[model samples]
Target: MTLELSEPADVDLEAVRRVARAGEPVRLAPAALAAIGRRRAEFVAFVEAHAGDHLYGITTKHDVAARTVLDDAARAEFGRLLPPTPPSPSTLGPALPERVTRAAVLARLTDILHGTAAIRAETAARLTTLLDGPLPAVPEGGNGDPGDVVALGRLLRPAFQGTLEVGEGMALINGSPMASGVLADAVLSGRDRIARLEQVLALAAVAACLPDMHVDAQLGVLWGDPHQERVLARYRELLAGGTWPRRAYQAPVSFRSAPRVLGGVLRTLAHAQDAATTTLRAASNNPVFVGPDLRPPLGAVLSNGGYHNPLVSPTLGALAHAWADLAQLVTAQLNRLTDPPDGIAAHETEPRTSLFPMTASGWAEQARAAAAPGLVGLGRSGQTDTSTPDVLAWRRATDAGAALDALLGLLAVTATHLVTRRGDTPPPALAGLRDAVLECYPLDTPPLDVAEALDAVLAHLAAR
Candidate 1:
């Protein structure tokens, strides 16, 4: 299926996913074609009429070399001055996964569709076609050529070598499309993981004998937090089919605060998705053009800093922290249920269920350490080079998500242990999870064998 790209607003995470992950094609709608053409005409006229070497990236050098200017001959050579992209490092090191590359391509196309750069319709069309075939390998440890110019050039240059015109080369490279594209994938993946993890939390709550009132609707009303209300309400649905045995003491801070932590995941990821959406639609073209339309000949060549997107770092960083917080909470729940030293847990369930499941893995601590936020580089006078921290942000978020896999498996099996020892059937919401976990490690599977059983449990849960 073809996903149509029209207005800048048309580009979103879902569209990018379809084209990037599901292998769908994209079409440039006529309206976008008209907007792109109109903007290109103005930029071309400005470039052709001006002889001075002040044409932003087209005529001037990049980064600290911005002080230097190229002559008319260099500008006229048609993309000759553009730096050559480095060779693919796929054999030597890791390459960007197929989905991220496709997403970056779509992000770049959306940036151009904003009509801020003077790229030809043909350039946009070629980018559209590139998505249908084997995309170029963007290595993992990318040679951080300024603004990813080399990487973008490598992707776009194959479109046409001889006539790759002025402004087009830099336009393809400028902006935070890499950050936006990566964050888009993070948001989508994070949402799915958070959703499924919530179900696991429901199972943990039942296994731990949490009072249903802990997530009752009234708690949301007292706190005046609608997010908490919604989160608690979900717990109710998942816990309804089963019964919660009253406990002398309350559930752990993790369960008491599950609504808050889970709500935090929802809030932060929405903010991250919003940040990505804004970036996907925005034009980060330096020396951006204003057409002679409204405001009586708004035609002007404006120098601006539209390239670096600062929001990507903080929002994605916050998301990583959310995952970290969840990891800690779930770890506490798993240990509380499995560890015999916790007198409260031992009172409610069989002592034979005792085993410190948290001891089996230290993923929670690792996630906590990675939760420290990255800085958005605002270039200062003495710095060697300004840099984007999105790559680090991407790394942290990915690791944060990965740390959950084993931790969740341990929690899943431990919850099943509680359900088995207590002679209780898992509630409807937890039944499938309990069944999957026990199927991997049946009732006879010893607690000491949890290490060996984790792979099978994780595999089972993931397949669902």
Candidate 2:
């Protein structure tokens, strides 16, 4: 399917997921393309009319070279030159995954289509053309030097840097689109983890005969948290018509409060999504065109706002911290459910699942350590320092989500293990999930790698 870039503001998490994970093709709408072309022409006319004027990335160089004047030859050379990107000491790792890079590439295309970047239509078209195939490797670490210019350059270098014009080079690399796209992809995947965990809860609840009062919708009104209701609503749907213990003994705190813990995580996830949405639609190019929609169009003006996206940093941190809390909650449930002095795993003995809680405990520790907010720092240029560790923050949150995925999958595996060992019957509604979980058999070490077992279960859980 083709995604048209007409109203760029309409681009959201699902769009990024489709393009990045599903490899959907992108197309700029005719109107947006024409507007981009006209804006590019108008910008050129504006520059020619004001010859000898100093432009941040056009007639003059950037950063420490800000004051350096360039003749026409130097200007042309500067335009095509992919400047050395300062090393990212804070972010150290492999290139961004292809899906994340593809998300960033798709994000950059939206900015060009916004008509504020003043890039030639051909450049934008060329970028979209390349989106049809394999994407270049973008480094995971980068200085927030007016956005991920270093990584953006590597992605664009093969077909892009050779013919860049004045200001066009900056337009290509300038902005927080990389951060935006990373957050978009992270939020999408994080939501999937949340859903999978919910399913795990469904299976566990039925297996334990978790108290109905815990999932009762009225409890949401009593709790006073707006997100609580939606979580309970889903639980109610999944648990409806499920058999419950006739005695109605209260479940342990781990079983009772899981929804509340999840409700709080949902709040934090929404916060990250709000921040991602803002960054995703941002046309945050340096030297951005001032009046592209004007009758004659105003030329570009350089400002520090293009690269100043601190909100993304803390929002990512928040997500990591949230998952850390969830990991702890999952660990508690795992412990109670495993030995089941008497809750979910009542009268159950699954020796193989003994280490599952520890695995989740370890992940919780890792995510907590990585949850520090992005550090804001001054750069070598000493000129601008709106730099936030967005790249690092994005990595932290993405890794946290993965950790949560494993923790929840392990929980699901444990629940299935006990239920099958006891030959229990779950609610009719959970029959399919039971079948899927049953397929994740032989979790013991003879042939199945625990990780592989979890992977099989996770793959099935993800499908639901």
Candidate 3:
């Protein structure tokens, strides 16, 4: 996919996700490529017009001494010169090399489309080409900031070669796309963890059910909330097969609220998606381009925080915590599903005997004995064997477990949602639940990644 540059506003989460998922040799749409080309041309034209001007980086002064201008052609040597300044102390480890830098280049183009920054369209196109072609190897792990700074410097270094102007280095280093991509990738990765968890939940349900269980009513309410009848219809489905309890019990009792549980996860992912897309199109640079149409002062102005990244930082942090939460949830659901005696209320009877356990009386004794907390170091022995069990703690543990399951369910929902759309399925509501196990597993093709998982969610809903 050849890219034609356009404003970042035109791009979506899916676009960013596509690039990240593709990882290498990502093609920009022809139109976007063209736009980048045009923007690059604009910057070149700016350099040409201001060739004689003592305008900071273009001619003379750069870095901290950017205010000190130089008008001589010898000043062009400044562009080729490596930074003489000392590196700042940082705890972010090292910068990402070319592989990660390629992502930055693509994101930088997005910033260019937002009409901010100083990359010439041809230069930008070159950068894009580099991204689309062979990229240099970047070392993994170290300080992300310096590594990014060095990576971009090295990347642009080849193109700018001996002709780099002053501010050019700064231009490459200061922006938000790289960080935003990290956040975006984090979100995608987190979502993937979630999808896998949902798959786990389904498996757990199957395993825990002594007899097959029906959770249709629970799922139906989630699929469509305002429609009470639809919710009840799902309830009826659960009651079908004559395999259910006489009274509707909150499943796994806690799982009865699966719809609500899953719904929250869907909504959070949607919010994260919106945040990511916004950053993608945002004009993120210090000295921003206001375009020829804008008034003089702000046109060439260098503003602080114009290219700032409050969104990416918090989003990344939130996304990391979300991953932990998701891991906990899936692990819990798996525990319950595998432990039917703990989760299930009843079991078939058997007898216990000294030599041969066979009668109902013996079976009852064994069941009672087995039901007792045989857990060592449980500290339950402090109480009499007849002591009342801590039902509240038991319930709390169950809820905590389900909460984890829901976390994973959210990912599953998002994954299914995205894949379905990519496949040309209708968009599903990001706030509802599916009607049954069958509805949840609507994907014809198994998901291969986070995006695929989201697509599956969408496919399920679209099929509905």
Candidate 4:
């Protein structure tokens, strides 16, 4: 399918996911191309009218030497020279997945289309062609300072040699779109993880046979939050027709508070989504173009810091921390299932032999450690910018991915144990999940790789 990009705000998680994961084609709407052309002309007029004005990184040097002014010839030289200034050597690691690189390229293109970066319409069209064609391999590391710029230059220099104009290369390289794309992918992944988490929580609740009275719809109303209402509604739907008697008046805090806990996660994921959407639509370059939306638009090329994203850093940190909390809750549910209070031991063997619980605990610990905020630093580079939202969002995405894997593993193990204890008759809501679990990890055999199992479960859920 041809994914349309008429406005940056229209590019959401699913849009990025389709291109990044599904290899879908992308196109700029006719209106976007026209607006880009007009904006580029306006920027040129503004530049010619204000030739003596000091513009950071455009008419003048960046960083501490902002006072240095450059003539038109020098400005052109600056564009050519600045991209290679922070030459980054490649390091050893897996290259960024093609989907992510494509998403980043498209995201940068989206920013340029917003007309704030003042890139030429032809440059935007070339970028679209690059996205439509094969992309160069992007190595990991070199993500500090202008590392993204350097990496982008390396990736696109082969294609954009004769096509790009002055200052456009810097505009392409000097923003946080790569990081925005990374966060966009994370948001998509997090949406999947959140859905999976809800499924597992429902499975655990039904497996434990917690009393339906506590999860009543009235309780959701009394809770007085949209998140609680939504979660309670889902729990009620999932736990419907469960015939098993309650294990106790209240099973445990984990079982009782399942809706509330998952609700918090859902809310935080929404916040992350909002932050990512705003960043996706924003002009994250140094000197943004500001003018009225008309021909011969009067505007100024003023220096700004839209690239340093304050919203994404905290949103990512919150998502990581929220997932960690959910991990602990899942771990607690596992404990309850393994060691029920009624003396009916689910696992007759010792805790060491009971690999499921032990594995879940280990995964939970790793998630908690990974949840530490990535924004805690005094900043680096000569600019001394304290927070690196790009790096933080990347790390947070990794952490959230790992946590999702571990959570899926725990859910599979929990579902398997529940089936074993109850003689293969899982509740209707969990019947499909049970089948998936057993297929990935048969009862007679040891569990497979958790990551592999997670991939299967995610695929299963997506297919459903």
Candidate 5:
């Protein structure tokens, strides 16, 4: 998977998803690295050729009025004059600059692809290395301003010692990197988590044995919709030949419309995936090159909000909300499973009658009894804070992350019971999926302990 800058490459959705959801590493393709190297060399050459001329960030000093042009020899010396250190601590602290440095490196790479940014090949290589390397720890405490550009400038000054020239220094430091780094990580993770969580919502409905109308009808609606048919198909593939559907017929109305609820979740996950993909491939920079030329032969460069990451924050928040919604759904499924009154059993007349002996007083009810509070608390906090955008936007995101782990615990228990009840007659898809989840992200808590808590919650649901 070599990605070439000359001809655009498919933004690796899997890579983005893995990093965002699993907190994995990010890597650039050989072609991408090679392209960046070539561009870096060209940029450095251009700087070396016109070193004496007056340019925005190159020959002349930055954050100052453009005055006289310096010769190529003096330009190198002029670049050495570091700006005065701020008297007070920066407000945003080190996080802002860490992000900016990250973004600047990315921007520089993009600019290299455009045959601009006039840096060296080694510089581009170093930038890519930095992108793929461990993110250095950034001190959080400071007192200057919210933007924190100066802090970023100071941190980047050392890393960029041999690489940056006149305008390159300003170019690297001028844009929003902190937000970019956060946004990149956030969106990438959001995409990955949403995909699985949305699927979990569907599985939760199936586990609840909800009504077929609520379950499959929603899937039908999703199938009819333009974009969701693919995801709906995946769900169908997951459920085919499973005894869960037959078991649902014996349950209450809670089992109905399960598909629709899950389908909606799938739809939302699709949106998050799309948004994340778009952001990942986007070039967020300022003073972009017009064409093949790094230093344009004529006219000033183009500068705009292309690099401003306002959309990433909101999208990240939205993805988090979707996860919260799915978590609540999972909690509801845990409620049905653990409640004895809910009566989870396959009808004797159903096709898979040989799968299990109907049992009302199984592990579900008992498990719910112990696990209910954490689930309830998570649900309440998520809903309580939804009164304003601040709650839904920020507070909910935090709550959703916690909710995901809790729900994973619940799902593990439910799947365990399903495996126990099915014996040898279980569908391969369901059996394989259960095994996969267990093997991949094993329950953080003892299944029996979590099941008991689920039992407590089930009791609460029955009381309600």
Candidate 6:
């Protein structure tokens, strides 16, 4: 389906997911084009009226040379000279997938349509064309300073050649469009993973025969957290009418506190969604247009530092930490399901002695390490002044994705182990996941490769 972008408010997490993950097409709404045209006209008139005034990168040199002023003739010449110079690192290793590149372009288009970047309506149209076609590949491994900007500029320059007007190219290449796109994709993927995690947790609860006590309506009233209440409702829904025997008066903390822990994850997802949606809709360019339609005849262009997105970093870190906590819970539950007191000791067999436990432990450790918050300590050199939000967002997304993968693997393994012990009769709610798990590794066979099993489970979840 084609997504129509009418305004900044239209760029939601689901639209981003459809474009980035599903390769859906997008179009700009007529209202959005009209808004861009109005803003561009106002900005152009303002710039012409103040022709001699020095504007960063518009009528003067960039960075340390901003003090120097250029006349109209020099400004025209400067535009030609400002094309991003190719750096020592020519290409980003294993170029970003086409879906990611498309999402980035769409995000930039949203920024332009918001009418803050002062890009011509035609420029926005041209960008839509570029996004509709193949996008230029962005490079990796910049010095994490303005190097990321330089690299993005070089990558995007090819697409705009012979089509861009003065100051427009800089607007396209500047700021955090790449970061915005990457983070949008990450947030979408994280949301899906969280949903999958919920399903797996429900499956685990049934496989281990966790009591329905925690999800009782009375208990939910005591918990009081909306997120906890939602989780409680979902758990009750998944386990209703199941006749599995409760193995103990209380499951381990991981199982007993499952609703609360998963509720925390839901809260984190909500925060990340808010931050990502804000980033997607923001005009994150330097020298953004600002003026009062009521107070001023022409809007003024003001220098801004909106490109440094402080929210994306911390929000993604929170998501990673929440997923890590989920991993810990999965590990504890898996251990409980395999070792003593609650587990079916009769099912403890050979060749797979440490396989499931070792796999869960290894995955849990990796997830924990990946969950370490990134982008902390703004006092660090280059971060406050020249750090690239794109790089930071990309890394955080990568870490979060990895954590989800490991956690999914652990859950799949544990679910399979449980089904095997219970005479292959899984609860109705988990029947689909049980069948998917068994399809990967049959009964009485040595455990299938953990990574292979994980991929299968992920594919199944995606299909659902």
lDDT of 6 at 316: 69
Residues 49-121, model 2: lDDT tens digits: 6547777776778776867768878888888765555544434658788888888888887678677788888
> Which residues of candidate 2, in runs, are more than 4 Å off?
87-92, 142-146, 244-247, 292-300, 343-351, 384-386, 442-451
Error of 5 at 10 (Å): 7.0
Tens digits of per-residue lDDT, candidate 3, 271-386, equal 66777777767776755655554644223534445444556544443443333343444444433432335321112111100111112123233222322221111222321122
Query: What overall lDDT, based on C-alpha atoms, would model 4 receive against the true structure?
Result: 0.70
Colliding pairs, model 4:
none
List model 6 lDDT by residue over 283-330, tens digit each.
887767764483287777776786667776677677778877877888
Sorted by lDDT (best first), the order is 2, 1, 4, 6, 5, 3
Error of 3 at 250 (Å): 4.4
Better of 5 and 6 by lDDT: 6
- Largest lDDT belongs to which candidate? 2
Clashes of 5: 56
* lDDT of each residue in 1-464, candidate 1, tens digit only: 89998877788888877977798988898888878887888777776666464656776655555565677777666344344546645564576677887888888776677677668887777768888898877666653433555456655566656656777766776666777777887887786686678778888888777876688788888977666677888888888776546566788787788787887777777788888888777776765666667323436656676766777778778888988878888788777776664323554444335444535347887888779888755544642256676756776887787777567777887777677667787778778888878778776566567556777988776655
Write down the TM-score for model 3.
0.58
TM-score of each: 0.88, 0.91, 0.58, 0.88, 0.61, 0.89
RMSD (CA, angstroms), candidate 6: 3.0
C-alpha RMSD of candidate 5:
10.9
**Global lDDT of model 3:** 0.44
* CA lDDT of every candidate: 0.72, 0.74, 0.44, 0.70, 0.45, 0.69
Worst 10 residues of 2 by lDDT: 342-351
**Candidate 5 lDDT trough over 10 residues, lowest sum:** 383-392
Q: Kindly report the root-mean-square deviation of model 2 from the true structure over all alpha carbons.
A: 2.7
All candidates: CA RMSD (Å): 3.5, 2.7, 15.8, 3.2, 10.9, 3.0
Query: Model 5 over residues 149-171: C-alpha lDDT tens digits?
Result: 44445555556755555555555
